[model samples]
Target: MATSTPEELPSSAMTDEDYGAYRASAALWAGTSVLITDQQGKVLVQSVDYRDTRLLPGGAIDKGESPAHGAARELLEELGVHTVVDRGLAVDWVSADSSGAPAAMRFPGELIHVFDGGTWNDEQIAAIRLPESEITAVDFVAPARLPDLLSPADARRALAALRARINAAGTVLLENGHPIAPTSLDRAGILRTPRARHHFTFHTAPVPDTLALRQSWGWVFAPDGRILLLLEPDTGAPCLPGGTPEPHDHGDATTTLHREAIEEAAARIARTTYIGYLSDPAASCARARYAAVLTAVGAAPVDAATGRTYIRVLATPEQALQQFDWGPAAADQLAAVHQARHRLGIPRAAQQPVTELASPITW
Candidate 1:
């Protein structure tokens, strides 16, 4: 086969740049952004004059500027905050596409860096300054509501970065707003559905053996002390694994816990301690919350009753709390779990993102 000569070769389809001044023509751009959150974990977003969708507060890196410094510069210019950001949270490789962008942007494929801007207090938030042009306004939004305000790709990217921050899972690399090897949060579909409200009365007393039992659930600490969290297969909501005593349970919460733990997570729990109970009049049942140390957690086996295996995660109490809406009682229950952990001599879990218990993830 004859090699094609330069005269017969076609020009590369790429972004117009360099004007043949230095290197081969190519379509590539670099930008930087910072993900800032308030003390309450709400993400800060900007509404700019050039686009209908809101975005993280950041902009293109100036020539000779490092991505980290560019992120800091953009933060200062856009928000009037002198905070310097350096920790990288995410790196997204956007594909080249100009069809949907503003005409003047040209839309070269971008290497976008997102840094952790850390949490800002109310006084800091109140001091925000906006320029006369570009960023028109700013808002701090709940993570679950991000999709409603940002572009689809942006929402996914933002949420993934947020989960990385929450997990302290280190910098996540991405392409077109998705992880290559999805994290536990992504695998279990965390935050895909809104957290449902739970109303109940939390009683600290050990549920008396005499009380007729209906439901049972509790925090099960792993060998490393992280609590076991299971996803509700239908709703994708996190739950403590337990249920009403079966005929074989003999009406004991501890016995019920043992059997339910096996069925729900393929876990064998030891050293069960009853911490409290919650009475949900709506459900007309009293659910006992206990704290137990895990003897072992096997690969998730298909639960005999439901036929669907569960998505299991190991979470710190704090991380687990964020995944559910228990109202004020959530705080109370969390306190009890900590107390139980203390009693059992289980050390607090180190800061990390919720991690999957290796198994055939039952979505």
Candidate 2:
């Protein structure tokens, strides 16, 4: 071909040999980690010798390596076990810190991929053999407690990843240590705040007249089968709507349920069906659990009892149950919601992430 002027050259025909800008991918660093949890839903973190902070069992990805390969390799090298680690739980893009040690250590910004390693039992945990260097110890820490123990970025990423796994829906994109737009689980501050456990003898009937009522709670349901859940800012623990019967309730459990449901969740429940009660004889009180239809859900207002607005959500029964530290009781609690839904002619809710009731949904 005839020699073509720089300006006359076709875009595709222009050669990088003369005027190409240097585009180097090497400027950015790449790291990989795995989200490994025990049966109790605690994340496994490694105590590395290079830093005071703890981190998930993962490290830098090497040249010519895919993130998955790097993660599997790191797991094999660090945990000393051959395992299949796939499924992207989260990918966090950390910006280059100017004054921080990373900049001084000759490090640039990083793109880290976190993959799901799934749940490991006691035997799998026992199988781990740490290397003689880098990692000193490994421990399974609660996701909420990760921030206290692990690095801030790692903590945020871990919590987000755990929530993603619980959501069982998709991957999360993050920057720094927070989600770009927090989901309902993130806004509720769950996985970071501990779940409250209710320990009592669960009954399949209404609170007995003989039992002194301590509080009333319900698995309030929407016509769509979603259950109404309430969260207080103090703990971010999801609880069924309802409370102790006040003098206003006139010693009626149903009355207490109706009033408290509106006050706590801004929800109006109709066609209530008593499912069961949680009898705590040691505390000399019983907490009644009922299943009711959500007739109307309004705006969440400041709860007079706590003086703080509660975070109201419409969650599947399973989502609500999994949030508690109930373990086996989670199954039974789910059963209670089922019994309520069944008797009330509401179908089981399709599995989904817990979502806030930002706007009113009236049936």
Candidate 3:
């Protein structure tokens, strides 16, 4: 056997481009999906004859087309919607061999890309025309109904994509529709906390971004149209129940709300609606606010062991506005929560809100 010397070997043929071509030929399929929402935040979906479950307006990428371009092509073909794909929401990897998948499953693994389809107006939604050959019917599905409307895999991907759209922080990486890593900051949840104007009257020395912390403020409501407020054990001032996002919360705003609701007020949140984030330019911090409805499950112990006294009071919206001296900023946040609740059509009854209750309402 004769071994070729380094000088004699044809190094030019084994260039980086050649290696890239080889890697690209690996046994993997790529597909793209879009996340289009109506004015009400419902997702756009179509009933397909090829599969039992509904699908988002997308399909597998062509041999030489980019993912975004493929998504755009699919949108035009599937729903006759003409639009450009400019932003991506999430990237998910699906493995055919993992998770006890049956060997009989013949499909190869896939790399999935999800893009933002931008919210549409009623006129645009009504103008959509689906291809009769592929799509049977097109309709908008609410987030709560996705699990039942779409296949399990699709539901997970759609939910993650929807969340990413809300956050608008950046693209999310996922495996089997789940996040690849713990979230560091939730773009959707970060918001400025309402503060008194006096705090902003004089510019305090800039606080290093490193010193800034992520926090969650919850607007918990009880049955009979009343909001839950906490009386500060020391100052007797009224405030929302919340605190810093702990590592244990897994960077999830809902998890933080669940834990804080119970710890601070012994209150159980039956359901929570993310009202969006409020930014505090003064503090250089973000506050994720949620409007949650309490169930009959929680109780405020007269003397809980929090090393301080916490009084949980349920008050009507008007009462909350009158009683709490929540400076202008906080007051604005509270008002916004109410407005969001109204728009979401969440009633203040003791029953579950329009949205499904967050699981395990307790910590």
Candidate 4:
């Protein structure tokens, strides 16, 4: 065929409508969300002038930008935040039909990528500069109150991201903002303690929703990278250093754990992380679990309250799992924490050689 000049090409083939039709896809919207947390684990959400409900600090991903980079860029543009996005928390695929009745006219579907903005101190939060034109106000909201402030879909997405952050388990995948079946947390059994007919039955916490139990326990770690395990003299059953809350156990679960550490292990904790909860429905009781770092204080060989000589062993997570039998419940707790630390990139301290643990306990 003879070559046609640019101007001689068919008029129907060169229209903008044809170009647009060729680029059409199943999805119409692509966005990013940043889940920013404070040192205390409170998520930072903003009230936008465009919407009554609060949202995470993020917006639509621009052309040629990665979802993570887009999230960080949106934070800087909207709130003047300079923090780096650490890891992906979640990715949600939402159908347009599920959004509302008039949705199909607007777009096909939506994809949202959520990233962890890491933790900031009070000073860093105070330093944030919000653009009044877009963001009306910025506040750090507790995870429990998120559902009340955000839409159901947004709330579920945020909560899933929060769970991923708290557990240090990898990213969560969602459809319509709800988890997509057995999540990493579910697969790892991080919060699902074994259930037995008469002994224990694990259940999720409903009210308050933060913990499974009022009573708490701690896997307090010594400076030498060993966890403190208390031994039962007669039965030799190993347990974390904690007990039921007392009248004076005030503040939060960490406060209760701190007191328990002092009473049970004779050690003071510098900091504590809320790992998760374990419920025993058969006994009508539940317990919050924590991983704590010991302060300068050391444990006493004997408990003053019982006047009994205690055999406390500081063992590596592997050794603790093997040597001392923590029963099914306690074993699950330690295993969950071990998995969390490994996932979160928390480094273990220098371990003592196996030969060094051969000596018998004295004093």
Model 4 residue-pair collision total: 0
Ranking by lDDT: 1, 2, 3, 4
The most accurate candidate by TM-score is 2
Task: Give lDDT for model 3.
Answer: 0.66
List per-prediction Cα lDDT, in the order shown: 0.80, 0.80, 0.66, 0.64
Scored against the true structure, residue 339 in model 3 reaches a CA lDDT of 73
Which stretch of 10 consecutive residues in model 4 shows the poorest summed lDDT? 189-198
Q: Per-residue lDDT tens digits of candidate 4, residues 1-363? A: 211443443356455554444446333688999888775446799998877789988889999888878988998999897767758988899888776636446857789999988778778888899875988888886566687888778887887776565444467788988778544332322212221222232222332454345577776766556677665454344466777776666546677788766666566776577676766555455677777775544535466556654445565665444333233454455567765455444557444421111133221
- Model 2 segments more than 4 A misplaced: 1-21, 102-104, 199-201, 205-211
Counted clashes in each candidate structure: 1, 0, 10, 0
Q: Estimate TM-scores for all models.
A: 0.78, 0.86, 0.50, 0.51
Residue pairs with clashing backbones, model 1: 167-353
lDDT tens digits, residue span 1-363, model 1: 221343333346422342342233453688887888875567899999998999998889988899999998998899898976879999999887722666597776888898899888889999999988999999988777789999888888888887777677899998888887678787666666677767578989766555566788879898677888888666567788887788887767789888888888988888899899987676566789999987777888888777777888888888887677676687788888899999999998988777778753221
Candidate 4 Cα errors over 4 Å, as ranges: 1-23, 101-105, 184-242, 245-363
Give lDDT: candidate 4, residue 305. Answer: 59
Task: Write the candidate numbers in order of decreasing TM-score.
Answer: 2, 1, 4, 3
lDDT of 4: 0.64
Estimate the overall C-alpha local distance difference test score of candidate 2. 0.80
Poorest 10 consecutive residues by lDDT, candidate 1? 14-23
For model 4, what is the error of residue 132's alpha carbon versus the real structure, in angstroms, after optimal superposition? Answer: 2.8
